[model samples]
Structure formats: C-alpha cells, structure tokens
Target: MITIDLITGFLGSGKTTFLRKYVKYLLAQGENICILENDYGAVNVDMMLISDLLGDHCDMEMVSGGCDSDCHRRRFKSKLIEMGMIGYTHVLVEPSGVFDVDEFYDSLSEEPLNRWYKAGAHITIVDAGLRLPLSDTSRYVFASEAANAGVIVFSKTQLNNPEAPSNILKYLNESLASISCRRKLKASETVAKDWNDLTDEDFKRIESAGFKTYGFEKQQVMDEHKYESLYFMEKKFSLDQIKEKASAAINDPECGGIIRIKGFFKDAEKGWMEVNVTKDDFTVAPVENGQDIVIVIGEKLGKEKLAEIFGEPAEVHAD
Candidate 1:
C-alpha cells in the first residue's frame, strides 16, 4: 500500500514550509511521490509556493474550495485514484487549516480508495504562537485538527525559547485530555522543531515515528465561522511598511479577527520578503522569489480596510 500522509494545521501553521524540505528528502530516497494539495480557498496559493520551491521533481494535483461540499470530496477521491493508478510509492496530502481531520480519514475507508492506499501518518503542525487563541469556539476547527493528529509538530520554534515546545507540548496534552477524543496520542508522538533548522536525520526520525498514526471517526461538522482570503497584487513595499500595515490590520477590530496573513512580496529596498503573521507573532524573511503577491487568510475580514492596508488591486474570495 502507498503511504498516505496527512499534513494538517490551522492557518499560518507552516504546512507548506515543512513540505518543501520533506518532499526533497523523499525524492532523495528515489521514491515515487505525489502531492494532493487541498485548499479551502478558490485560489491555490500554497500550490504556487510548492511549485516555486520543488519544481518538476514532484507530481501535484489540487482540489480547491470547501472540502465539506460533496463535489470537493469527489474531486479528492478522484485524485487519490489517479495517484494510485500512477503507482506512486508515497502520497503527501496537505489539507487546508479549516479541514475536517476525521472526514479525511473516512474518505480512505470507502471503496476503490481503501483497496489502493493504506492510511499512513496523520501529522498536524501547531503554531506555538496561536496556542491560546485557538481555544475560542470560533476556532473549533483548529481544535478538531489537534484532537485527531497522530504526531503533532510545532512550527516557529525559533521565536520561542528551547523549553517552549516542551511547555506547549504539556499544554496541548492537557487540552486534548479535556476533550473526549476518539483516539489518544502518546507524548512521544508529538514533536516541536523549527523547519529552517531541520536536517536530514531530523526528517528521518519524524517519518519513522510519525508514520504510525491513530485513526478517528468523522464528525461531519462545518465551521460556523467564515474564512476569507485576500490577495494583494502589488508587492513593492518597504519591509517596515509591510510589517506596520500587517500589524495594524491584525489589531484592528474592523478587520474582523484576522487569524493568518502570509504571502510573498518584494521589498523595494531589501529585495523579496515572505511575510507570515499569526496572532502571537509576525515574521518577515528575505526570499529568492521575484513574485510579488501576498495572501491573507482570516475570518470576517474587512475588504475595504484590507485593500487599503495591503495596497491596490486586492481580490477577496471565500475559502
């Protein structure tokens, strides 16, 4: 059976960042790999990033829009069938932050899917920064993702002290205990690491241990909160300007409780920069890409205010 790894996390949790290096490692092993990019939004921004980073070495198929819809699930199943027929040794599934973790596993138990592919690892990335904010009822989607994950990994660890992950791990375990989950994950199954600092050995350790995952039943619950994505077309802004605007936008109540802000932009003075912002922290790093677009993900965002903050030619869409 082909390995089917579910890479899940809440908004701005670093799923794409982890996959960039993980896919490279899989390719080095000479394994045939295929990626099924499942995004909740109509736009495939993550797919753009994966393509820019991995290029032609990987096979990719995208299932865009809300996964809760029957149409989306059919598309997803078709993609899985296609991958199986192609005989890929491994498949990496990157589901949107708002995805239903149980529904993902349930899809596999159905006909045609179960015969071809066996469930592999179900890893969820956690943004240590937003650990507290995710507790709100509006953020139940995030909680569900955590409750079902086999190996919970932390992203943006550099922003915190060495003990932060351990501390957060304890907090997460306690949180999971509070909820009546269908499956239980051991402490050893949860890990914390900075994607930038990972070495080949680190990847190997994760893959070796993470592949053994616990399965859960689907709940079929839909997020009551709205998730919207705004695309900033113009990218020529100073690093300071971009940071300042992001800070202002996230803090403003009129902005409708912004949860995640990410995208590639060109700093007029400092070259290209990648901006990733969660409620806990904001990060701006220089990147090699010349593409100048920034995608912001959040709930009930103010279109006019976002357009003004992100600059002109902003296109807003449902995720």
Candidate 2:
C-alpha cells in the first residue's frame, strides 16, 4: 500500500517550506516519492519554486483551484488513482492553505482511494507570528487543521521571541483538546520548533508518528469571492517596481485582505527572479532559469486597480 502524507496549514503558514525539507530527506533515502500539489489559485507558483529546488528527484502533479469544489474533488481523486496505478511508495499531498482536512479524510474513505493508499501521517504547519490572527479570524479552519494533525510543525520561529511559540502552542493545545483527534501531548511536548532547526532524528519521529482519526466535523465554509488570483505571463518588470506596486495593491482598500503573492518574473538586471510574499514577509532571489509567470492571490481584488498597480497583466481570474 502507498502511504499518503497530508501536509496542511492555513494561508501563509509555510506548508511549502516544510514540504521542501521533507522531500529532500525522502530523496536522500531513495524513496520513490510523488508530490500532489493543490493550490487555491489558478496559477501554481509554488510548484515552480518546488521544481526549481527539487529538480528531477520526484514526480509532481498539481491540482489547481483547490479541491473543495465538486469538480476539483473528483479530479483530485482521479489523480490519486492515477498515481496509484503508476506505483509510488509515498505520496506527499500539499493541500491548498485554505483547504479543510475533513474534506481530505472524507475523500480517502471512499472507493479506490481507500483500496490503494493508507493514511501515513498528518502534519500541520503553524506560523508562530500569525497565531493570533489565525485564531481570531480563521479559527474554524485553523483549529480543524490542528484537530486532525498527528504532528504539528512550526515556521517563522526565528522571527519571533523565544517565549512566543510556547504561548502559541499552549493556546493551540487548549483550543484543540476538545476537538483534536490525535493524542494530546504533555506540556513538555507542546512547544513549537523552527523547521530549519529540526534535525534528521526529529523528522523520523514525525513521519513515523501513528496515524490519527478525526470525529469532530464542523466544516468551515469557503467564501468563494474572498480569494482571487491574477496571472501574468512573460511580464518583464523591475523587481523594485513590481514590489512597490504590489505593496500598494495589497494595501489598497479595494484589494485588501491579500494572503499570498508569489511567482517567477524576469528581472531587467538579473536573469530570472522568484518572489514570494506573505502577510509577514517578502523575499526575492535569482534563479538559474524559470518561467516568467506572476500569480497574485488575495481577497476582494479589483482587476482595474490591480492592472493599474502591476502594469496590466496578461490575464486575471478567480481561483
């Protein structure tokens, strides 16, 4: 049977970063692995980054526009079956940040999926800095992720005070105790640690952690209009200029509530550059070679406003 590990987290919580580290370890072990990347946006900029990093180490498949919608759900299941047919020892599923774990579990219980694959581990990535915002506004989704996770990993630990993650973990333990299906950890085991700081020994525990079962089922309804994406192809713009415009667009009242902005772009000075933006941070670096594509994901986006800000994109649509 194939082991399918679900890596879930709320928006901008660093799911991709966690996956990158795990995949590197898996590759070193000579594991036959596959990655199923699900993105809420129509464009898969994360995939581009993943490909650039991983190269030919593993097979990759992407399900764009999320798996929540009925059409995409069916497509997602079909892809699983296809992966099974091709044969893989492990399948790493990186669901879109806005996704619900319940939906993932429900799909696995059905025909074909259950026959071919087994639940391996449930890992949820938490952003140490964004805990409060996540708890306040996205409690349902945030809590649901924690409730279903067997091992909870944290990101952005280096950016926060040393005492903050403990407080956040305490809050999560209290908030999720009643709903979480996985076994509870003692106070000693509840602190959140940085992904980079984790050693190989640490990962063995996470990957081999016992599978969990979730019974609590309060599903969070997705606000369809709340998330939208704009895609740009072959757009050549100065990185500084793009950042300036994106900052303005994200701050604009008409295009506020932006969650993530990332893509590969052609830099006038550099060869190819990749940009990743979250609520807390923005990063840009030169890549050897990559597609010139820009994908912006946010809520309440105004096309005209964005066009003016980012210099008229090739296409804009809902994700």
Candidate 3:
C-alpha cells in the first residue's frame, strides 16, 4: 500500500511552491516519492516546477481534465494502482487550483484506488498575505481542508502582515468548530511552540470566541464572487518593479474590494522575493535561490489589467 497525500488550494495560493519544498524535505529524509499533477489547462506549471526539483529521483503522472468530471478520477486511480504495482512507496497528488479536496476524497473513497492507496493527509497552501477571513468561501474551503487534515501547514507565513498570524488562527479555529471534528486544532506560535501547548490554546480560544470548532463549515460572506477574484501570474519581473506595482495597486484609491495578492519576483540584488498581499497590507521577503514565478490573487482585478499595471514581462530565465 502507498501513502497518498493530497495537496490542495485555490488558484495562485502557492501550491506549486509548497510542493517543491515538500519534495526537498522528503528527499532529505530519503523517502521514495511519486507525484501526480492534475492539470486543468493545457500548461502544467506545477508539473514543470516539480520536475525541476525532483530531477530523476521521482516519477510524475499528469491527469488532464481532472479539475472536473470523473474521467481524470478514474485515470488517476488507475495510475496509482500501476505505481503500487511497481512498488512505489509514497504518492503525492496535487489537484487543480479550482478542485476541492472534499470532492476529490469523496470521489476517490468510492473507487478501486482505495484499495491501492489510502488518503494519508491533506496539506493546503494558503497565501498569508491574502489575510482572508474564515468566512470567505475560498478560505472556508481551505480551513475545512485543514480541519480534516492530519497535519495542516500554512505556507507563506513569513510574507504575511503582523495581523495575518492571528487571523489565520481565528479562521483555523472557526473551521475546525464548524466541522464538529475538534473545536481546537493546535498550531505553532513561535515556530518553536510545543505541540501540546499549541493544541491547548486551540480549544481555549475557540470556547472563548463563541464559535463552533469542527464539522461542516459554512461559506462566509464574500464581497467578491469567483469571477471577480483578483488574479495575476507573471513569469519574471524586476523585484523593484513588482514592489512598486504592488504598492500602487494595494494603495490605489480606486482599488475597492481587492483582497488577496501573491506571487514571486526577482531582484538583481536579492535573488527572489515572494510577494503576498491581503487587504491593504503587503510583505516582500528576499528568498535564497528560487524560481521566478509570481501570482497575485486580488478582487476585481483581471490578468490583462494586472499585466498592464506590472508592465511588460522580462526575458530573464529562472535559474
């Protein structure tokens, strides 16, 4: 039997970046890994990123049209069985940005795939800079995914504003409460907080907050609809240019209802900086060597509009 981990998140939520990092972690632990990338569009960006990281140490399978419909589901299950037959140890499945883990799990649990692989856990990558309240449908779904996950990891935490950490905790608690699973879910406070203490705080805060901790969570009041979502994906850009554009966009007087923005950029001096924006707050940090990919999730902003604001793309290749 192979352990299968589901990695899910909304569009431009750092899912590919998280997968790359996780692959490195698994490699460090000497784990044999296989990756399945569900590509909704013709371009499989996540698979490209993962391939660059895994090199030849891992196997990858692409399931097209898996974002919706059962065709990809059946193909995915068949591939998993094939991998199991070949003696693969662990499998990681990254669904499309628009797909929900609950739906995927429900679909998988009923299939022949259940015999070859068990859903080990779910890891959702959230853009901390989005600063989304637990009430938003996207955030609610993310939180629900976390509530059911054996281990929940909030990525891009370093790029979040000061208020992000607390808001995330609030959302986590609220999601857990709605699911009726556990009112409190432990989270690391200092990145060094003991796991036991973290769990204790999860319950205490939920009880005091006057909210349910776990069960099926409801969607919150979302000011912007899915079509109105702010989304931007750029291959490469000058770090300074990205910062200036982001600052201007977030501070624009006409920018109403804009919520989340995230992506990566490169500075001549700083190498790579991952950008995350929530509400009016934004953060940019210099990362070591990383790919030159950036995505911005915002409300009411379209790709063409964002491209215009960010200027013409640069031709620099990501090392």
Candidate 4:
C-alpha cells in the first residue's frame, strides 16, 4: 500500500513552497514518490516547479480544468493508480487553490482508489503574512482542509504577521470541535502543547471524532543540534562517507536554515543516505531502507555543494 499525502492551501498561501520542502524531505528519506497537481486554471505551475526541483526522481500528473465534477475525480484517481503501478511508494497531491477539502475527501472516501491508497496526512498551508482572519471563505477553505489533518503547517512565516498563526489555530480548533463532537476544543492552545495532555481519553475522543489527530511522537527540544530546515545539493560519496558527512553537516554552526533539511546524497556503504532532519534538531532517519534519493524537508541548512564537500562516491547511477 502507498502512503498518500494531500497538500491543501489557498492561492499564494505557500503550497508550492511547502511541497518543495516536503519533496526534499522525502527524497532525503529515500522514498520513491510521485506528485499529482490539480489546477483549477489551465496552467499547472506547481507541477512544473515540482518537476524542476525533483527532476527525474518525481513522477508528475496533472488534472486540468474542463472535466465534469465526477469525471475530474475519476481522472485524478486514475492518474494516482497509474503512478502507483509504476512502483511509486508514495503519492503527494497538491490540489488547486480553489479546491475544497471536504469534497475531495468525500470523493476519495467513496472511491475505488481508497482501497489502494491510505491517506497519510492532510497538510494545509496558510500564509502568515496575509494576516487574514479564518472567517473569510478562502481562509475558511484553508482551515476546512486542515480541520481533519494529521498535521497542519503554517508556511511563509517570514512574510506573515506575527499573530497570524495563533489566530488561524484558534479558528481551526473551534471549527474542528464544532464538526467533531468527540474531541474537546481548547482555546489558545499552541501546536507545541505537551503530548502528555493528549491522554488515552483524548485519543479515544479523537478516534471517536472520526479523525485521527495525534502529535508528532518525537521529543521537541531546542538544541544547537536541532534544525527546522536543511538543504543539501549534489552530494556524492560512499555510503559510509555520506553518513559521516551528514552527521558532520548537522553539527555545523550554520544549520539554522529551516527546522529541517531536504536534499539528495550518494552513499557508498548504504548506496544513499537520504537524510531527514526533523524538529530543528539534526536527528536523521533514512526512509525506504536507504536508497539514493533527495531530502525534501527536515531540520535546516542552506544550499551547499554537498558533492564537493563529501568525498568519493561508492557508486553512481543514471539519474
């Protein structure tokens, strides 16, 4: 079975930016993945950007405008299945800015594609800079998509109003509570709320709510070793060397790029050490049993000539 993640957000809400980060994260974890882009208009900008960033490693599918409602979803599912048949281990869908999450979820929940694909996460991106209230339809649409999500990320914070994230979260919690009676809605709670607060009873409530919402299990700590985002470019080395270099890179003083890093690497011992930098700390995990892949997002560092920094490739394959 393939893990499918749906990325939803309003126009200019940083969906593409989030996707870029995510793709890098997956690549670093060495996951074989495909990206499906659904655009309301004629142009598929997200698809083209994904292709450019991931190159041959990503399979791109586009569902353009013109098809009837039913037909559009059918075509989308067909494209996903086709990508799955091609041996993609995971699929990521970036719906158009105008797409509604409830409709998309309902469509998938009732479909033939549901059997083959398990929804991993629904990530909705909101522009922090916009300073928009969730009451607006566009903002509501963004929140609705994330209402049942396993994870909700607010992107482009650098461009956002400082208080936007908190505002959005407040609205999201209330909305979620309104629709899901099982889970109690708490106000003024941040995403960094303690996991212990989510006791067994909370879990039961969440389960009963029909949406599985859980905090990331990893301990959230702020250490120099932690990173929010990191990026590596064209690093080639033996597996052992790749691991060593990654370890060293994570310890670098300049690791404050993002809370995570997503990039590609070639390793001699492991053939590849796709690195996942999670939680602003340099804790690394290999995805897909250590294959040659790119890292999309994890903990953070800026673009560096990884190939030159790391020495000697254990092997090379056509990309």
Candidate with maximal lDDT:
2
Candidate 4, residues 1-319, lDDT tens digits: the string is: 7777787765555577667666766776677878888754443434544555555566777876543445566766667656656777777888866564554566566556677777776665654444334333333344455555654555545444566667666666665554442333333222222232334443233222223453211221221222222223344434555456666655554532222233345444443333433323333333323333333222333345333344332322110
TM-score of each model, in listed order: 0.84, 0.86, 0.63, 0.54
Global CA lDDT of candidate 4, please?
0.50
Candidate 4's TM-score = 0.54
In model 2, the worst 10-residue window by lDDT is: 182-191
Put the candidates in TM-score order, highest first: 2, 1, 3, 4
lDDT by residue (1-319, candidate 2, tens digit) is 9888999887778888788899888877877889999766666666766775444558899877644577677778878888899878889999876676766777888998899888988888888877364433356567677776777777788889987777777666665654544545443433267666777888887787644665554543454544566776776666776688667876777865677777777766677887877656788887666787767776566777777777677776554
Better of 1 and 3 by lDDT: 1
Per-residue lDDT of 17-111 in model 3, one digit per residue for the tens?
66766666666656678888865444444565455565456778887654334555576666666677765667778876555455556655665
Candidate 3's displacement at residue 216, Å, is 1.4
Model 4: weakest 10-residue lDDT segment is: 216-225
Residue 173 shift from truth in candidate 2, angstroms: 5.2
> What value does the lDDT take at residue 199 in candidate 3?
48
Q: What Cα-based lDDT does every candidate model obtain? A: 0.72, 0.73, 0.56, 0.50
Candidate 4 regions with alpha-carbon error over 4 angstroms: 107-112, 134-136, 160-162, 173-319
